[model samples]
Target: MASQDVVYTSTENHAGFKIDVVQYQPTKRPIEDRFSVSTKSSNRLLLGVYDGHGGSHTAEHISNILPTALLSHPPEKHAQIFRETDHTMIRAFTRDHSLLRPKSKSSDWVHHAQVVRAGCTALILDIDVNTLIASYANAGDCRAVFYPPVDAEGHLRQTEDLNAKTPSEQQRLAQEHPGEDLVVVSGRLFGRLMSTRGFGDACYKLPHGTIGNWQHRRYIDALSAVKESGKIPMNSQYHAMFHTYRTPPYLTAAPEIGTMQLQKDSFVIMATDGLWDCVSSNDAVQIVRGGLEQEVDNLAEHLLHSVRATRAPGDDVTILLLHIIHT
Candidate 1:
């Protein structure tokens, strides 16, 4: 198994403004999270963060492909881009599985299964300079928190009031599919994963039937072999112990997309669930509020430290802070 890098940091200039990103992976899980920031036509800014589980292939693939899809697709409707990306991911993973099935006896097939069964939760932010609105797409629990400047007295508002009004928190899910609401089986997401929607995890996303059931078993066996060989330490039994008991397509890649108007002297923080697992939304805002007053580079590090202080074993953590300087 590939070992994770301890920390990663970078800054991007989005339409002449800066967006800083930071990631910390204290565990040895291959740093299964990925992020991207891109621009188009000098006005549109696209930013994304992907948190992967089971494996990193899905997150890495989306981080590399989703931005290009957005840029090349017609701008008439941006949400459609996320749908297109989801469809493409399904097609790509299906094709890869088909090509490997014929050679299932080979070690290559096991490795391919490891990669194909990987899942990734995603959060995307699209900003158009002309409108001063930030469009967001979320699949799974990765979150985006926007913090307006504190009052002249130098105190930030309570977490509930700030988060209650953020676009990410207010967007309601329109009923469309059965699995849209999170389902828990034995405290695990769908009883196997932590996310209800994401890319990859084809074994879980497939319709419940003979073929899907067979694939699930195959994945479990492969994962066990990898773990026993010391290739990875991730617990495969939790996922193997449960099966989809409800309708077909127990998990989805469909993204929840919405928009938020930007305001000056405010900051938007996007991060993987790792951060939220320990820090509350209000606490996170307070931390960033202090960071903005001091330095941006310390924001990510500070958040990670705070999460660690909670004494909970942390997950792979990634933070993207966008200070709305001119938006």
Candidate 2:
């Protein structure tokens, strides 16, 4: 049974399987999403949608290590791994420099895992009591959509966090740079290689160096701290200084790093760029609603079928569907 992002009068039945089909590649990878159901008081249900760019290396890296990364945290860590992983991911690009470069020793693909230059985007949803919080983090074009369920009447209702972007975000952009487009590109799935924010992408080659906020006050503060610490002499050779100090790598799709109070009528959908690029948030929500109302079987397959029907000619599609049954 699937529950929408609404507080329904009756109990909602919710259970789902994440699905994927990677096109344009010689090999089909197992889905990157990792879903687990736990009996803990929080009734932990972890669902992650990872979309990778350059190649599947980024996806594979997250698929293999994210579980371990989560394990590294004793639940008391409260997403500390998120930050550590942030550093761990960038440590490569910083240490090695050049995300577009074919990394060997430091690449997650070579030494530890078989990862490549690919960078990944992720959205994780955790279901705790009286709240179904979803973390929409990505360095690429993956996305998460929340849909609230309605009754036989076909009415619709959902959580307030459903809107995209925000006025504050616009204000923040204005504060940062006046002329720069607030929503650079459509922010649509297939447009920008790296979303406004994400995890593994390196500094993009642009006429201006404003890919995102990667080179902002945080960087200045970091540079100031490093300089003050006297790690290297101010007049030292540029090469030596660069070798000593470097900025952390960031995913194209960085999570808002948020906490939301989720109730029933909560349905969460996360998928890689392939799916989100071809499909819009509203379109995805509609498909789930339609599937549940009509056949009510193989919702994942139904989603894939719809995505295939609408997907672009050259797209690598992967999707992970989740329904938040109980808060």
Q: Give the candidate number with the greatest TM-score.
A: 1
lDDT of 1 by residue, 1-327 (tens): 112434787766565455777787867546889998877888788889899887687788788888888777544455676666666655544444452545445565555555446778788887877776777777777888766634686553222211212333323221323443444434455445656567776655544346545554544454455442345433355344444333445556666667776776677888887777678777888877777777756566656555566655368889887776664
Candidate-wise lDDT, in order: 0.64, 0.43
Give the Å shift of residue 17 in candidate 2.
Answer: 9.2
> Which has the greatest lDDT?
1
User: What is the Cα root-mean-square deviation between model 1 and the actual structure?
Assistant: 6.3
Clashing residue pairs in candidate 1 are none
> What are the C-alpha RMSDs, in order, of all predicted structures?
6.3, 11.7
For model 1, the stretches where C-alpha displacement exceeds 4 angstroms are: 1-6, 74-79, 95-115, 149-183, 208-246, 295-298, 306-313
Deviation from native of the Cα of residue 283 in model 2, angstroms? 2.5
Question: Which segments of candidate 2 are over 4 A away from where they belong?
Answer: 1-42, 71-80, 92-109, 112-116, 129-139, 149-196, 202-254, 261-265, 310-313, 325-327
